[model samples]
Target: MSLAFLADYANSDDDSSEHKDIIGGNNISRSEDSNGGQGYCSDKEDVGHGKGWWRGLVCLVIGQNSQLQELASACMDRLCTGTGGAQAAVKPRYVRVLGDLHISLTRPFYLQRHQLSEFARELESSVGGMGPIAVGFGGLSTYTNEQQTRGFVAVDVDHGKESIRRVLDRVNLVVKKFGKRRFYRSPRFHASLLAVKLAGDREMSEIWGSGLANEQERIAQLVAVRIDTVECMLGASKYSVALDRTD
Candidate 1:
């Protein structure tokens, strides 16, 4: 229950102008303002189709400004190199570990960003038992017409593939109870920093228009992250949970 998803957000590029350089354009800088954690999401841009409950997980950053730097470093370390986007768009929340991951008991009447603080508290009180932590991630190449979201996060990990497998197995238990109508799709773990509505009944469209599904699949395969702490959000404020005491 202490699970929270980590968002890799806009690579080194926050502007998002150059499509070709989209690989790692997010700019996350790190500093003394540091904290770390483990966190969720399914494939098909894990954030897909969960707007009613999706409160988004926070990013694990060392510093608010330096958050982008950490992301860049992580990408470069694992990916070798990447990206291009508007430099200014990157912010402490957008470029770093901004919010927590917890489902909202209340749903917004209209399309709007749901607050995360209260839900985070709920997670701490409820699911704080699961631990050791595992995290997985991948970026979007494109989002299909039906996909409601793009992006992935996996957390509360330590063991490796086995650790991830264990969590997924448990998550599947919760997922099985819910019908597709609530999800209207498979359960995917994801984070949303910026969501845009489709203009004038046109329908929402992904900026990349790329293969987000495939991208998420690839990241999950490649990563099985380890974690120590996590954040939860609900009612707009943020909350934290420690993994050390995880059962």
Candidate 2:
């Protein structure tokens, strides 16, 4: 989880003239729009039908901020250009940048319409009193989904790990009561910065080694994040629970 290699790669020029900007016009602002439609209710008719189940996820959302947005833009640019085969391997449509960042407190699950109110109420009661947490980025890292269909580049949480874990513990309790799966037993808390669908079994590291190992300290200093609210997404609906702000 280091970013030292980026320094060298950032300066190298691509020899291929045909190399298109994988990022292209889809820069910072556009990237945010890419995720806008997801996890949101589109049809008015889908609002409240207690007969059906809704797909759900609980997480600590990283709201839009200038600093993190800049870092994410930089990470996306360098990773796509610097990595040898990344530009060609990357599916631009799948890329996710700053605005979509969040740390999952529970795995995606299902909630029946009748259970939504109780679930949200219990979750709020459990974590509402917790104080806001200041979290820092450790460095860059990579992960593949359970099905190994897609790959992700993310920033690991360097500080405030325990506080996040405490919140996760509470979230899991609520999830368990609803008969949903809890999060990982050993979680590596991170905010996914970029996502891609590679052509084959090509590992992201094959595109480039994790990140700039030598530049970790500098990167950590460049990014500072805060978590004060936890959001639960059910279908297109959202429920936000604010943390205690009192010092």
Candidate 3:
């Protein structure tokens, strides 16, 4: 029915640089767990403003700790408002917005801007020789689209998933360009906070399995993302591949 425009620019914000608010906005401070409440919001980097030239290679989901990012951004803003507002053709799709969460780890497809500074200096020397990388977020998953249903939160590359498939095979061998694709032979890493379009197709999966079953059981206890640096959105503006932690 509606895949929300195949992902409405896949979390547009012009590639967000950090406009704040991804959970708790800024006055973040909540305590009291044991399922009582509080477990989300851990933001500090968000930027957006779309322009066009879509690019990819993501990795931003650091240490959730704002009551599970304010209960996964309020359960993806109540499943993007259950799409009852009726899908518009070019706008009014605001179920909620703020940083738009992420954790792609490569799969975006598109490059140009003069080949993006030698593919961002060979992807920052191949992620600084592959160092710091310990992602995890176990639980919750979905990817349907007969009408829409893109909820995500399952990324636990325990053994570092072959070091992120060798940094997505060296970013498809230094981004040759021309709509690249290679990156998902079996890669299932995710972090997308939410997305809904179905109104009858199981009504947003029964409202995300009973309204996010107790915040997905306290977020399936397993949150930890630390991969140094590698943002790159390109087009709306945003590129990074920093790596020098050495710790």
State which candidate has the highest lDDT.
2
Residue lDDT tens for model 2, 1-247: 1000110000100111121222211110011112221432222333333558765667786766666567666656656665522434344454555354577677656678778667777787777758788888878777665445455666778889998999989998999988887877888887765555545687667654645463455576655677888866655445667775432
- Write down the worst ten-residue block by lDDT for model 3: 35-44
| Prediction-by-prediction clash tally | 63, 7, 24
Off by over 4 Å in 3: 1-55, 61-109, 113-119, 122-207, 215-220, 231-242
Put down candidate 3 lDDT per residue, 122-217, tens digits, no spaces: 555555445556665656554443225432322233446666666666665655443465544565655544444344344434544544344545
Ranked by lDDT, the better of candidates 2 and 3 is 2
Compared with the true structure, all predictions reach lDDT values of: 0.29, 0.58, 0.42
Point to the candidate with the largest TM-score. Answer: 2
Question: Which stretches of model 1 miss by more than 4 angstroms?
Answer: 1-122, 138-185, 204-207, 211-224
Estimate the overall C-alpha local distance difference test score of candidate 3: 0.42
- Order of candidates by TM-score, top first? 2, 1, 3
lDDT tens digits by residue: candidate 1, 41-122: 3222333235554324332321122332243334222221112221111122322232333221111111124333333343
Candidate 3 residue-wise lDDT at 110? 50
| RMSD in order of candidates | 13.7, 11.9, 17.7
